[model samples]
Target: MDKHFEISLQNRKLLYSVLKDTPKDVLCSIPSGFKNNIWWNIGHTVTVQQGLLYGLSGLPYTMNMEVANKFKKGTVPEEVPTDEEIEAMKGLLFSTVEKAQTDYKAGKFKEYSPYETSAKVTLNTIEEAIIFNGFHEGIHLGTVLALLKAVHHPKAV
Candidate 1:
């Protein structure tokens, strides 16, 4: 469990660096042939983690639903989020994981509702969900990197 948590933390550290370093314009730009941008990928990862680990466990999510909904699966960016929202999510990228660790230690997650993801993988436990979330985040991180490449090198798309 600690290894899983550590992997997640490390993944987020790399992700946070991307979020912190990317310019607002580049973060928001949906490059040619890309349906979503870097900001969506980053926010979506957090929302998916909350849904997989907390919401599936029948525990309240650490993220605000209003903000979470903006990044939920199948949703695209409707409008640029406020700078404050981006700042809030930047903090949540770590704080939420910290809270999940605390809750796990406290035995807060007792059960999880099984869910089959779009990729056809079903997660049956919080631990499985956490592991799966890492995979999911990695995919989004790749997408973010690809988007960055496309944004910088227009022909890359």
Candidate 2:
């Protein structure tokens, strides 16, 4: 296992912990000042990983396009997530990383189209994307923490 996958897996593990430990109501709640909820962040992270890795590699997405697109870039969290959608996101949390690791070991990523992320980082390879994904996940993790605080905050509005 390379370091990138290791880091990515660890990040996913933390997020998975959040999913399992947090109540469903809290997970589904969008803080008063937030644009999206913890649920949206979770789905967004998974969708972004699939898009950046599989989609950019000219391969099919491991997740359902209809569900995944709901969390794609430029999408909002106006509608609350269904239980089915929540379960699907939870299912992908670890499987996507595991499958990506397997695919990478099997040389499934033959080519990559360079993309400049909004953060000004340009990824030219799977390794870079995977590593950058950790950073992306970290940001969302921070957002989740903030959302947690907001949910309990008196000034959440």
| Per-residue accuracy of model 1 over 37-101 as CA lDDT, tens digit each | 98999999999999999999999899899989999999998888788977998899998888888
Name every residue pair that clashes in candidate 1. Answer: none
lDDT of all predictions, in order shown?
0.88, 0.85
- TM-scores for all candidates: the values are 0.94, 0.91
Model 2 score (lDDT): 0.85
Position 8, candidate 1: lDDT: 83
TM-score of 1: 0.94
Q: Which ten residues in a row are the worst by lDDT in model 2? A: 148-157
**lDDT tens digits, residue span 1-157, model 2:** 4887888888888778777777778888886788888888988899999999999899999888988888899998768667777677778998999999999999999999999999999999987888888889889888988887888833222
Error of 2 at 37 (Å): 0.5
